[model samples]
Every structure is written in C-alpha cells, then in structure tokens.
Target: MNLTLAIAIIAVAAGVIAAAMRRVPIGQVHSLYRRGQPLRLLEPGTHWVVPGLDRIGHRIDLGGQVLRFEQPQADSHELRGTVYWQVLEPERAEATIDEAPQLIRCGALAALGESPLAAGDRRDLGSRMKQALNGALRERGLMITRVELEIA
Candidate 1:
C-alpha cells in the first residue's frame, strides 16, 4: 500500500510539472492570464506558470498577415484588394488580434468610399488606403505594409 501511494504521488507531481511548463514557439507570443485576468505577454521560450491557476489566453502570431476585401461602391463597381500587415507590438495588440482582419476590411472600405474612384487613380488610392489603415491600426500595435488593389 505504501509503495502504491508513493507511485501515485510521483505520477501526480509529474503531471503537474508538465502542465506548468509551457513552450512558446518562435515568431509567436502568448498572452498569459491568471484566474481570468490578463497577466502578461510571454515571448518565445520555455515558461512556467502555476498549474490550474494560470492559463494561456491568446496565442498571437508575430508574423505577417494578409487581408483581402471587396467593397461595393455607389457607382455599382467593386473595390477589391489585399492588405499586407503584421503585429508590431504583441502587448498592445493582444486584445485586437482576432479582430484585426475585420478592422482592416472596414477601414479599407471606408477609405475607398470617401475617395473619388477613377481608373487612372487606382495607384494613388492604394497608397491612400495604406496610410489610412496604418493610422487606425498603429495604436493597436498593427501596421499596414502594402495595399494591392485589383484594377477592374
């Protein structure tokens, strides 16, 4: 009975240790939470957390992302484009990482809607949209690197 109890305790300890150790991969950041509250951002490496008391809230990719959107204009035409962006600050972006794509899409549609559309102005429009998106996304720790609009 004593030997069985010892083995059981050792197995439980191993399980707890395994649960406490977290390994974050390269080019990714994890948001640590304690009892449903935000704690901190965990960078790429091995980390330890209190078993059952702490959890990984969000796993944010520190890599580039692409958002493709299509918006219809009053002229019955459509504005379609791909936006290239990435997370510059995971700490500030943790809250909006999941909504980044939707935010970019909405911002792009609004910017395009405000501009006068013309075949000769597509290039200028792309640049303007990039600027507008970056302006809105900067505070969220995201940046628009490039905006590619399809000429149609």
Candidate 2:
C-alpha cells in the first residue's frame, strides 16, 4: 500500500510539471497574461508557465498574411484585391491582433472609396493604397507589403 501511494504521488508531480511546460513554435509569438492583465510576449521556444495563473492570450503568427477584400461602389464597380501583410512587432500588435484582418480590409475599402474611380490605373491605385495602409498600420506593429487592387 505504501509503495503504491508513493508512485502515485510521483506520477502526479510529473504530470503537473508537464502541464506547466509550453512550447511555442517557430514563426509565431504568444502573449502571456496573468490575472487578466497583460504580462509579456513569449517567443518561439519552450517556456515554463504557471499552469493556471499564466495563460496565453494571443498566438500571433509572424509569417506574411493575405487579406482579400471586395467592396461594391456606388457606380456598380467592385473594388477587390489581396493585401499582403505581416506583423513586425508582436508586442505592439497584441492588443488588436485578432482584428488585424478586419482593420486592413476596412482601411483598404476606405482608401479605394476616396480615390477617383475614373483613374483607370490599377497599379497606381494599388501603390497609393499600400502607402496609405502602411501609414496607418505601422504604428500598430503591422505593415502592408503589397496591395493588388482592381476595379471590376
């Protein structure tokens, strides 16, 4: 009976230790939070975290992401294209990481809407939209690498 109890205790301890170990894959970052407050950003590696107290709030991917957006204009033409983006600073983007796609989509639509539809230059429009988006997103740790837009 005594031997069985000792083995059980050791097994339980091992399980607890395993549970506290967290492995964040490469090309990704994790935002750690404690007691509902932001703590720190965890890079790609194996980390030891307090199982219950420390929780991963966000799993931010560092790889480039594509956001496709389509907006119907008042004249029946649709502005559509793909936006290439990536997170440059995980710390700064932690707060709004989940909404990054939506933010980019909305910003693109707004820029397209404000531009003259009769311009007939998709390349120029794409470059302009890229600049406008980069201006707005840089502060949030995000960047627009390229914008491919077409009015159809």
Candidate 3:
C-alpha cells in the first residue's frame, strides 16, 4: 500500500510540474500559442501555462544586437561587417517571427541593392546604411540603430 501511495504522489507531482511552468528571460520576449494559434506575447517574467494546450513559439530578443554579414560582390569584392539593430516593440516582432539577425541582414542587403556602392570613403558610405535599413524595418517594429561595415 505504501509503495502504491508513493507512486500516486510522484505522478501528481510530475503533472503539476508540467502544468504550472513558463518563463521568459530578461531582454527577450516569447510568443504564446493556444490551440495552435497565436495568442499573445510573453514578456520577461515567470508565467503559468496550461500543459498540452498553450505552447511557446518564438523567443525573440528585445535588446540591441549586431549581426555580421559578408556581402559578396561581382568583382570578388566582399563587404563584411556588422549591423546594429534593436526591437522597438517586442509584441509586434511576433508577427514577423523572424530572428533579429535575419532581419538585419535582409534590410541591409535590400538597402545595398537600391543604392549601388561606388569608390568613395567606405566609412562614410557604410554609416549611411542605417537610412536605407530603417525604411524596410521600421514598420516591422524594428529599427536599424547603426551600420558598421568593412568594405573589402
């Protein structure tokens, strides 16, 4: 009888552990899904989730981050450096569901496509990339803070 009782208690404990548990770390946000549909955004905190019902989707960083990319050119030239960006609205980032690095790279490449790079001061031209990136990213609740590039 005692062994059976101990097994019962252990089962209950496991169930409780699986049910009442969720956490979002600082400088990040997570998207919650219920019944396989997007529910809401979970900010940094301890949260409670319904086991087997509510699920966590993407964990997006809210803090500033930089992504280093190597952009290859036709003349064997490659511009390789990092781009800085920050999430203005964590909740809105859920809609895009794309990671920060991908977003930064996409925006930077798109910007470079629009304006062809020419022979000039690379520093001056690289710093101006932020202007082009913001045009694509601002609507997605992200903004390009700065662009640091090394043109090779």
Q: For this target, which candidate reaches the highest TM-score against the unseen true structure?
A: 2
Per-model TM values vs. the true structure: 0.92, 0.93, 0.81
Tens digits of per-residue lDDT, candidate 2, 1-152, equal 99999999999999999989999999999999999999999999999999889999999999999999888877877878999999999989999899999999888888887544764678888999899999999999999999987778
Please give the ranking of all candidate structures by TM-score, highest first, separated by commas: 2, 1, 3
Computed on alpha carbons, the lDDT of every model, listed in order, comes to 0.90, 0.91, 0.78
Worst 10 residues of 3 by lDDT: 110-119
lDDT of 2 at 44: 98
Query: Model 3 Cα displacement at 91 (Å)?
Result: 1.4
**Residue lDDT tens for model 1, 59-152:** 9988898889887766777778999999999989999988998999999988887444788788998999999999999999999999998745
Per model, state how many residue pairs clash. Answer: 0, 0, 0
Give the Cα error of residue 132 in candidate 2, in Å: 0.7
**What residue pairs are clashing in model 2?**
none
lDDT string for model 3 (1-152, tens) is: 99999999999999888677888899888888999899888888998887888898888887788788887866667777688788898776677847656767876776565344566756676666787778777887888787777768
Clash pairs of candidate 3? none
Question: In terms of TM-score, which candidate is stronger, 1 or 2?
Answer: 2
Off by over 4 Å in 3: 74-76, 114-120
Winner of 1 and 3 under TM-score: 1
Worst 10 residues of 1 by lDDT: 112-121
